[model samples]
Target: MTSSAANRRTSLSAFLLGALLLLLLGGAAAVWALNRFPQVAQLAGLQPPADALVPATQPRAVATVPIGPQPLTNAVPVDALPATEARVATLEARLARVENATSRAESSAGRADALLVAFAARRAIDRGVALGYLEPLLTERFGPTHPQAVATIVTSSRRPVRLDQLAADFAVLAPTLKAAPESDSLWQTMRRQMGDLVTIRRADQPSQRPIATYDRAVARLNSGQVDQALAEAMRLPGITAAPAWVGNARRYIAAHRALDQIESAALLAR
Candidate 1:
């Protein structure tokens, strides 16, 4: 029985030593874990100094609904495209007006240049030159109204008026015209022949007698009153010079009338 007790005591001591060794190895492992992981140390109630611990992150601020109007999702604003389009349209209208004005100004300048050329051509025609090189320019500017009018003017301008020569010829013709008349009485013919020689002298007074009337017609022709002269001469019957003078006077009147028409047209066009 004493031997059994001694073995039992030795067994108890061996068991105690084995338990102490295990407890010491567990404590050393826990210390190593605490050094490697601070979170583990904090969980175990071993907090580190404030400087040694990582800082905690703050909560992010969240955006709330806008106070007033919210912005649209479109990349361009809803009203912006229309406003830009209106501006473009306005600019385009302005550009069109400018272009139209420029075109009108250029047309006016071109017409004015053509008119100058036409006037020069008219002067040359008056000097008895042919229509020649300037005919196209005059036709473009003026002949559209009356094509024949241009031809009439050019043809008439080339003809000589010759009213002075016609007047001198009419002086030679007046005696034959006054000598006898089919429409006059014998007393009237005798009165006309005597009045041709007799001098009635009142400087301010005018005479309507046939001899005095023929004298007035000759005076009108000398002064270039061709239409008036021809009219006065036609009143006296049996004047041989009437037909030729009438033809020339009609031609002169037509040329001047055509010139006036072209000038008026040019002014109105401007």
Candidate 2:
């Protein structure tokens, strides 16, 4: 009985090994048949789509922004490639033109802002305030030329001054300087007082009296000659008492001179 059982077990192991070998061979044969005949794969539901079965005849279309090469599966027809490339080129050219236009507009806007700031700085100078506020703006927009002019003006016009108003004040103060000096003799003082009392000069004509010098100074100040007016004023006897007026006149002259320099620099900049 032991001999019979051992033989039976050996026969069963041989049969199982034979079955495994047959299954492997059959699977390999099926694969070969599917490769050789597509109809066999289709019948077995293992065939790819018809489009996938053919090799791509055209290159794939690339994006305008360039994301690198694409696969053949993402390829397009050869006839449609020229239209796609032309469209991308046209879009790129239009985008370039738009960028150029934007650059030009920004440049123009920057120039406009500079000009406006220059105008505002001029107004501030005229008003004689906030002068320091314009220095950096002028330096940034027009460089050292305008900023230097502004600095000179600020230095020269340390005191606020105006020629027209100063002339009016001088007109009101002229009568005070018309009297004779305290150092004069009694005879001269009497004669001067008598001459003033008997004075009958024409209102429309220039006088030959000491007061005529003050009148001339007023005219010079009215004509924008602050230096000449101040010179004439200094010649008067009691001029030292009006030091504030003379100082303001000096500032007026200096400020205008600095303004002339600014104008010259601006013209050159233009």
Candidate 3:
């Protein structure tokens, strides 16, 4: 061949070989980028490999316990609780009974003490009445005040005089035995009359033996025989029927007896 035709054929062949090498290198780079980043590959409209995709894990199920009645641990038994309550009730009732009995006993003691105090007060009043009224009346009429007149009356009478004689002697002393004034206390008048009634009853005995006994006692008493007077006075109540004034007379006698007892006790104490 000629020289120009040979140069043109060599250049054309070199250009076609370089174009093939560039296309191969570009294909290898694209494959390496898709392996490193799956998101880039997906955005480029490419599907990811099976190894790059991860599966979601499933949740496990939990076991449940069945609910039932709980066992009694620290609670008291239902049967025993009622019995304990009944025992407590019985103890309370017994305590209440005891308290009531104690209250009644205290009330009884209070009433007894009150009665004794009232009795003592009555005795003191009776004693005062006897001393202040009866004794003075006796002394004024029968003994010291008119001793001569009493002596004349007793001497005129025979020993163991009859009831008629005794009535006469009382009649002679009628002026002294007059009723007390309306202004005076009834207690004073009653006490004064008690002495007179005793004197009359003592003299008006049915039997001569008692009459003699009374006359002798009066005679001794007028002569200051205190013990003999008390002895004689004590005997008169048994012989006579109880008059309306008997209670007053008995109270006077009891007062004197009590005084005698008190004096005796005092002397013994000394």
Candidate 4:
């Protein structure tokens, strides 16, 4: 067959088949719609047989109960539960506050302990010095025998505060209190003189200036005049700039040592 004639024959067959399928589908759709709508089914020539119209008849009644009160549960009381819960909550809150307070108290106590230990160490060093125990000051002076010095002067003596802490306090008080260099320096110089005076009691020759100051102090003290000794001490150079407490401690410790030295000397002389 020719190509154009074959194509025309195929198209005619497809068109006739499509029209037959459409007609069948339309008829099926109308029958489905009539069944779904009973009213329309009667108009579409559908009807029930005459014997199907009658219906069975009957009646029934439902029984009802009279009204009554009812209990919710046999569970524990609301008042009891709330009271217990409230007690627990209060106790927990109080515990939290106590824990916080305990932590603060622990911190404060730790600081206080450290300060006290440092002060004790300072006092120990001062006492050692007065008694001529060089071991405390010079234990680590020679070389690095250990990671930490066995006897650091600052830590060697236990006192009210560490040496560094004292230095810090001094730094603050000096500037804020308008403390004069002369005022503190005077005390410092007097303190050194006091040390020198103690050394004199030990028969150690210091500088000529210190020697002269010591001579005057000794003479005044020997004359049974406290004011005179102080007057002489104040006149010494560089004594005006020293802190009062440090100066006082220096003299006090030295004087105590001097008494010890004097007794030793007297015993030896005898």
Which prediction has more favorable TM-score, 2 or 3? 2
The candidate scoring highest on TM-score is 1
> Which TM-score value belongs to model 3?
0.26
Could you give candidate 1's per-residue lDDT for residues 1-270 as a string of tens digits?
A: 999999999999999999999999999999999989878988778986656677788899999877998767767876799999999999999999999999899879866875686577657644555666666777777777767767776676456444455667677778765445676798987776786677576988666466767888888877867677777777665565356655766675576567667766665564
Clashing pairs counted in every model = 0, 0, 0, 25
Q: Per-residue lDDT for 18 in model 4?
A: 100
Candidate 4 has an lDDT of: 0.50
**Greater-lDDT candidate between 1 and 4:** 1
Q: Candidate 2 at residue 238, lDDT? A: 56
lDDT for each of the candidates? 0.72, 0.72, 0.49, 0.50
lDDT of 4 by residue, 1-270 (tens): 699999999999999999999999999998888878776866656766434656555566768775796666886787799899999999999999999999888776755543443344335543544213533323322223321333333332333222333334334443322222454577775676576565434357433354465456556555544345545555445445545634543443443343333223323321
| Ten residues in sequence with the least summed lDDT for candidate 1 | 156-165
RMSD of 4: 20.4
96-191: candidate 3 lDDT, tens digit per residue: 999999988877675554344334423444333222232333234334433443333333221222223323443343332233445568787677
Q: Tell how far residue 85 is off in model 4, in angstroms.
A: 4.1
From the highest TM-score down, the ranking of the candidates is 1, 2, 3, 4
Compared with the true structure, what per-residue lDDT tens digits does model 2 show for residues 165-265? 79777877676666556677899888876776677878986554667678788788878788888888877655766777887777777666666665545
Deviating ranges (above 4 Å) for candidate 3: 1-76, 129-270
